[model samples]
Target: MKLDESALAATTNDLTREVDARGVADLIEFRMDQADDPLEQLAAYDGELPIIATNRARWFGGKASDTGRLDDLFSASRYDAVEFVDIELETVRAKEWLAHEFRENDVQLIISHHDFEETPDRDVLDAIIEQCAEFGDVAKVAVFPQNQGDTLTLLEAVNDATNRGIDVAGISMGEIGSHTRVIGHLYGSKLGYAPLLADDNDYAPGQIPLEKLASLIELTKNERVDGQVIDTIRSEVSVPKELTLSD
Candidate 1:
């Protein structure tokens, strides 16, 4: 429920199979916008894992439309299993009033921003994260990077925000920036999202399979303790950030 540093969540449209990933996932991120009958599925959900309800909008790389999207998220907050609710940073900016409702309900908010094209500059990224911090419990940024350099820009923003005491989740989407997803955790990112099954279409580019990602995170952390230089491990190992537990 409370997203702490290094917490990994599985993102899925199908909640029925969520129990299949119980041991691996800290929580299940229900992609409400992608589901055919989201509310119905929620009513039937009795999975062991806690839920982070997200009803993403079409304008922000999801299928859900504007109509009743916010209403649905509000409804989801009432679910006993749901501990976190994700709202697009753009949506929050447009509908400032929703912040009051979330606060009144005492629902934890994950304010997210996505850049499908390219990771923004450090200044822009910092500003976006600052704005997100003001509106929600956690500031989450997902960016598409053209090259490794772009990932650094994202990491820089993450570092800056975290250093300033902001709760943040930074993800560099796509192949070029995949490493940032794993590496960002070292910089104090509070959350990482992955898919429950391998071979499933990734919600974002460069997402590492859940099983591999978890192993890599462990390997790297142990390596850090074993006196292996993290710089070397990072350069040689192609670790990704987003999770997917594939068979």
Candidate 2:
């Protein structure tokens, strides 16, 4: 299904974690760069959760080598379990060939931006998100926030983008801005990602533990509303299991 509403995703490199993530996260992000036998795992996947395939490049803060990385992701994106694919906005915009290929595979896209240094100002954030929205089905921006103000700026950008009807996910990394991952969904951030495995926090800093995030989403499930920011609410998030490929 389309990422048309608020949802949480468990970010992991292990396919086995998918079953455990059910009833909590709406999606499982399979990190091909980190997984051993990634394609072999994909071919064997019989789990319940739908997958969001990601083979992050080294330039994008991932361990994957530059050579054949896109080719690997290309192969991953076509798997039966994968419904969404996360590609860097830079990569897609540079050639945009992958974006077109993903479309032909009948998979949705999440064009993401990452700022490992610090969060950009509102205008730059908006511009990046807007450009991503133009290139794919969802626009995702993940940045390291130096302080509370930086987190606030990211939130405002998420709110503005959501009100403008863009499917987006806003993540403020590190301990300082970790709260945004949970509260972002309340502001119409279409996706919230949490640690899927025990050591997964190294890849995604300051992430809420998967189970805790699930509880938080469950507690606030009734508070989910539509088309508003902050004080408003969104409807209940989709049941994660319901989106499984087996269905």
lDDT of each: 0.86, 0.87
Q: Estimate each model's TM-score.
A: 0.88, 0.87
- How far in Å is the alpha carbon of 131 misplaced in model 2? 0.7
Clashes of each: 6, 6
Between which residue pairs do clashes occur in model 2?
Answer: 224-233, 224-234, 224-235, 225-233, 225-234, 225-235
Global lDDT of model 1: 0.86
Provide the lowest-lDDT 10-residue window in model 1. Answer: 219-228
lDDT tens digits, residue span 44-162, model 1: 99889988999988888888888999899898888888888899899899899988887677678899999999888888999999999999999999999988888888888898898
Runs of candidate 2 with Cα error greater than 4 angstroms are 197-201, 222-247
Candidate 2, position 82, lDDT: 93
